[model samples]
Target: MATFGKYFLIVWTILFFNFFMETQAPPSCDHGWTRTPNGEACVKMYIRPPKAWHSARRACRDEGGDLVTIFDETKSNFVRDILAVNNTTTAWIGFHVILTEERWHWLDEDGTPNYTNWRYGYPDEDFWDPMVRAEECAIAAWVNGLGAPWINYVCFVTYPYICEKPLPSKCQWNDTVCLNIHETYDGWKCLKGRDGVARIVWPETYPPGSSGPIISGYALPILRSEKRRRDLQ
Candidate 1:
């Protein structure tokens, strides 16, 4: 039930990911995300004072990413440093204690974390409060309180948060309108369709477009852009 354009976008997205991820070079972070040394992910802090953890997560998702999820010690330390630098007391992350399983995991259910940074004697399972719902959220706690930097907090509690998503590769095109269109669609531009025909994007904006006449050497860039677009979409 998907359109041809939509299908091409999906495929390109998957292929172009390597240009930024696991790369020897990533150029730089996107407009908002902060690029790390390894360029594994782009992260941003949302220090709008406070919002319920759930609402904070939703905000991140709306921005085409999700609440921060610390997957390893390096990432954990990086997050802690961000907090320390900003003098943040605590922030929501994509994590919660799975009370039924008695284990911490990303809210996306990526499975039990290979690494953990829990505060000692915490997540007691025995911990409870009338205002909180069954102890189902975690925070990047300040390193002052009970020891470690990770702890559980009420899901409804308002707290600043971090959001993260993968960074995109640098793409330069001479056409400004084409550039804007590509950026809008996760950096993918459909220059051609799979049917060996011109597939000009934003036809109203650009007349004498692909639909008008097929040009030589146009397929490659279009195909590449379509691939990235699909993955991001």
Candidate 2:
């Protein structure tokens, strides 16, 4: 019983440490960018005078992209990576309250508010417009440009637009499968078997077929079960 208690305590301590480490880890990237071995898809805009939200959208559209939309982990990581790399505290994103109050939308082909990555205490109507009932919104960098933080800005104030261009796909390989490492993408690569041996392939050199350690920066390795192996093959 004492031994079991000791082991339990050890396991609990390890779990607590892991949780703290994960929580304290630095943010991987900014709010609306993604990273890839090939390159990065960034929310690029100028640091000129302020612009309204609509104007900002137009500027991004003109550049073959929209303001910015972080729909998933890939996009989120990409943005975080860009911000960290540039040491930028904040920047503009593609989100604004359009017809409805507090109902944000992205100024892109899909003008829907599918996802949001706003920081704490955001979308505040600090600067109100009597003429417009709905509060206009735009991404602001460095919190009023005073300090290095994120803030929401009123639309109609002209600022440079940030755009996102899709990155081209690259070839990726995994222990069990070969996948097309395209931009804006995600998928699994391997699975485990009942035997406990991870069903991974390290292809033999100069054999019947092209085989080697599947290596693609984008490709992920996974373990497969016997049943999955048959189906995948």
Candidate 3:
């Protein structure tokens, strides 16, 4: 009975510690990305040698993100500030009209055009007129009197672009806090995952009480038996 009570207490303590760690974890941005002031999303801008809409998106995807999409006024302002800070007069955004339908859509999974910041007399609805070239893509531009608003443009035109991706979990779990900041772990080496994410390699020897790999504080605990099976393979 005493042994059973001791084991139950140990299990309960471990569960409590894990829960506390997870609840305290905060969202983190990937390397070379900046989080918005409101903590909405991680964003990065490609300014040099501007590319067309499709090319810009491709470039963004290479960095594990997609062209910035603004679903609301807050996101619109966040992207606008990024462009403004960089002195980018104009840049391609993710808003566009699906050629088959006149309705506008965003490049993000939440494609519904719930919000817009169109400039006056813009979008032109030129798609309706067979003689005019369709202005399928949107660009955020600064007007002398008006603040930055979206303007429709042809998709092929080259412009600076912004990319946005969801914030990745910050791996704050380390065996020991070394005095040297760069040396996050004592003897383990850092490795980059295929998805361009950084992960700390676990050394063969581990400190006492290490039940499983510490992927992140927010991740679910992996069973020790399963981990041993994986190690064997």
Candidate 4:
């Protein structure tokens, strides 16, 4: 009888969860920004009078983002298309020389670029010298009859720029489930429970005897599944 009661409780919980989902909205980007097709980040192009590389990056920071970082061919192409669509000839990206590391790196990333789209005979070695290291900044530019490609330029040169920020990852309605699973849960901080495990209060509407706080599960496959669904959407 106890086993039957537990089984019925699980079924009822799932039903209520599904009903709750029907009224919840999916995660979204801020106004004036567009989410990437793969949904990993948000991007916006600033077309005001061109600003120097540092100034442009500062503007993006003021808007809660940093200059865009292109990680691979897909992101490179996406940035190119955006520039082409905006009639922009060139724009500052986040890539810049790390003099100490002797390699180019994105502002928000630790490692050097795994993929790059350098134009012919570019990323000029001239500025790699220690004295000129501060001068080399990267830009995406369109050449006559050629696709957009990156070129190293002096940091003081003014150009419109692109800004990119991470997409919101807060679970739409599964925060309690996600908080118990990932240490980096974006929704809310987890609280220590009586048993020294992470836990959350059960929804008052759940099965009658289940109104108290519940312990974190050994695994939260539901949260993982939700993340996959969000990424795919």
Top candidate on TM-score is: 4
In candidate 1, position 147 carries an lDDT of: 31
Candidate 2 lDDT, 65-114, residue by residue in tens: 66766665556556555555555555566766655444566655345555
Would you list the C-alpha lDDT of every candidate in the order shown?
0.62, 0.47, 0.65, 0.69
Error of 4 at 137 (Å): 0.5
Candidate 3's TM-score reads 0.65
Candidate 3 segments whose C-alpha is farther than 4 A from its true place: 1-27, 37-40, 109-111, 133-135, 170-233
Worst 10 residues of 1 by lDDT: 172-181
lDDT tens digits by residue: candidate 4, 1-233: 99798667867754543343222243578998887767767999888988899999999999888999887777878888888888988999999986767778889778756888899999898886766656679999977666679999999988999998877655433331223223223222222322434433344354444423343532223323556645523
Show model 4 residue runs off by greater than 4 Å.
129-134, 169-233
Clashes (backbone N, CA, C under 3 Å), per candidate, total: 7, 30, 0, 0
Sorting all predicted structures by TM-score, with the top scorer first, yields 4, 3, 1, 2
Comparing 2 with 3 on TM-score, the higher-scoring candidate is 3
Question: What tens digits encode model 1's per-residue C-alpha lDDT throughout 35-58?
Answer: 654565688888876888889888
* lDDT of prediction 2: 0.47
Look at candidate 3 and give me any clashing residue pairs: none
- Output the better candidate (1/4) by TM-score: 4
